[model samples]
Target: MARLAMAMQQEKKHQHVEAPDGGWGWVVVVSLFISSALVFGLLRSLGVFFVEFVRYFGESAQAVSWITSIGVAVQQLLSPLGTAACSAYGSRRVVMIGGFLSALGFILASQATTLTHLYLTMGLISGSGWALVFTPTIASVMQYFNKRRSLAMGLGFTGVGLSSFAFSPLFQFLVQLYGWRGALLILGGLSLNIIVSGALIRPLGPTKVIERTKAKSLSDKYRSFFSHTCEYFELSLLLHRGFLTYSLAVTFINAGYFIPYVHLVAHSRLVGFNEFQAAFVISSTGVTDIVGRVVSGWASDLRHMRSLHLLTIWSALVGLFLLLLPLCSTQGNYVGLQLVSMAYGFCAGALTPLVFSVVPEIVGKERMVGALGLLQLIESFGGLLGAPLSGWLRDLSGSYILSFVVAGGFLIMGSIIITTLPHFCSCTNPPPLSPKDTKNEFTEEERLKQVLSLDSTENIHNTDRIPETLLSQNHITLEEIPLSAKRTDDDADC
Candidate 1:
């Protein structure tokens, strides 16, 4: 009893210290920047190699399209497992193991003579590795900051755009110089840098301090397993109205999101643009995409603006710009295509960071690990099939025009759905605070901070909504904890 009490007290003391949001957290941001570069950069630019595979394998367009789709599917599908592993083990161990697997998969892929062999090595193995690295790294960024979370994520994710710009031309050059196999070998070497990124992951969230205890009976063990699984997966978040609607919007947004990345260059080629001009359109998108991410993030942080409104605006614009792609193709001017590409890129980049940033607000950050995992798990289906859907449309229509239109339609639908967020859903919730009450008002983040400031036993049951005072003495898991623990008893504790 004495030892357990002391351990609990120490744990309480440690969590009270606010996250060092700007200090070593910046180092984690840098690490995530490199990671986003490698993961998204590679995924985005795989189109440069799409033509080569079609030529060499004599495969149909849809058949060739499944290669990248399978990788994306595997990456998104396994995000829950990645979160569970990060929860059980530390982020560093899982990510380093992931890095090794990624490198090994690519190295093996470089020697593959069959498409199935590419699917297994490159799609399954390397994609699973990406899951392990991506889930925990982004979760850590959300955990490490409150006020500046969007800005931090914006800075970190800018790597994707910057890297997409560099890698498109670089992969084209590598393919020109040494063939696809040589390019895969060099990329295999580059994927190992995730190990260095993994090294920089320092666990930043709530501390899990276990007491010395004995094993349990069979029934008890099974119960423990189920409990831990729920904790890891956060199935309870399905109960939150805000989270459900936002996740649904994400599903639609994701259904349309990656189409341009996968098909824009090929679309340019179909429109009579030369190799450099086609790649240049993608590169221009990358540059403005970087600018949009930073600017949108900074805007979302302003006093009166709601992040959801900004998110809705950006998503609507992503769809509108994608709809303009076919029109740009019709124009057949290099500068016109580049301008349209930049417009599409800017909106897409603007919404990407807000996608993750708004989740902590929807569900309290306390339940984020499971909520985020589930969000990705559900969104994986969209990521998996969106490209193939485009390819299938391409085969039928004999042009990429119909495909871009379908993609744009889904994004526009997503924009409509996000307007149902809490701030807009009901008459009760106000849109913004006046400058006078803003200081006195408590945002959800502040409310959570106040709850966490309580002693651990008391804090456990009061995560949501503001509490007038601590009202319970019991320590329980999140599933059992109420939004407020208000009680009638005044002197229940000594």
Candidate 2:
């Protein structure tokens, strides 16, 4: 029994060291597809239900807006907690719990009699479940693939676009047939798919926990706990300069990124469009969004293109499309509206894949979970207020024009801010990968050859250029390992 246990442990360690870029990764991607399909896809299509709530509950647009706003805000705000749970217990366990809570939230919401009831069930309960599922699924998908990270993320997130396309119309049909209450009940049952998604997420093997010791003092135990906490939650990222800069830009971007999803359908109604026409607007965006995400995923993977650069371009384009929205609503005809919606959807979707990919390039993959959680926690403020503020503007001014323009302005500001990052200092230069980028695509034999071969030894320093005075973690110098010493080591391996 002892030998069997030891062998199992060794096998797990070996699998953990070897990147399984495909095999189970495709299963993980399918799980991500379903999770994304239900989570944000439903959220984006919630605009179809927005007007129903206003009329049923006798609330103003701004007051009713909190229904989705609170849900989105809660999801983002609690992401760190959810991520911490996933890190402590595998992703599958955390997400399964989330799936149950999510279904319960919808079940409770189906019986809601007041706006407050909706807030508790639909907002807090459902949002908490989303927080658990989202970060874990996304972070897990990234861990499975190194070479095709961008493409995997693109495919996983495209679920949002595909689901959004079908959901908007289907939600409208369901609401028409069964009313919002019955719709909620049916939606609750549909949300059970999250459990299957969660179950599909196999454990990534046990995380390396530090061994406890009887010899350690209480103070030592406390210090060790703090260290593990920092590693698990990546709290140290708060102090990282690169993280701070990128986060600041995303903060600005989030302030407006969700405005269209929440308000565009309502905006169409206000501008004299019928129910079908309004829903079609969202559907159109969903259609183009699919194309944008897939194409940009491939684009970001280009040998010469940087993810951050692609992000900048996409952000700028999204802003441009938002700025054109008011024109589409007022002076522009149906053709103009379609064109602008297509452009906006494509650009917005294009930006999604690059956002997460750029993080691994800036920080190492090991810190990805924490970095994503912290970013979500910080950006929750924007998600909390973005739609409500848009609703408030409409309440005050009786139009969405100024609101959309301001949203576009926020994105434009974000696009400009990201350019000031260390990599963007020069338009022609790609920002060098961080010193800790341990992503090596080389097979075991190739790695052995590189480590042992005496030819082109300088290439061991992977980054563009580094001075001898500043030796990075991955860098090896002649003074440290003379050729004579390397030859002796190589001969032993042979």
Full-model lDDT for every candidate: 0.74, 0.75
Candidate 2 lDDT, tens digit per residue, 1-494? 34323433343333333346788988998898899888988889989889999989889889888888898888889988888887667789888888888888999999999999999999999999999998888888887777788888899989999987898888899999999999999889989889999999875555323111211221122233344455456665665667778887887788788888888988888888888888988899999998999999888777467788889989988988999998877853666877898899999999988888787666555467777888888888878888899899989999888789888988889889888787675545444443233233112213433343423333424332222111211223235432201111000000
Mark the regions of model 2 whose C-alpha exceeds 4 Å error after superposition. 1-16, 208-225, 426-494
Q: Which residue pairs show collisions in model 2?
A: none
Q: What's the CA error at residue 382 for candidate 1, in Å?
A: 0.5
| Top-scoring candidate (lDDT) | 2
Clashing pairs in 1: none
For model 2, how many clashes? 0
Error of 2 at 447 (Å): 36
Pick by TM-score: which candidate is best? 1
- lDDT (tens digit, per residue) of candidate 1 on 343-410: 99989999999999877666655566667778888888888888899999998998899999999999
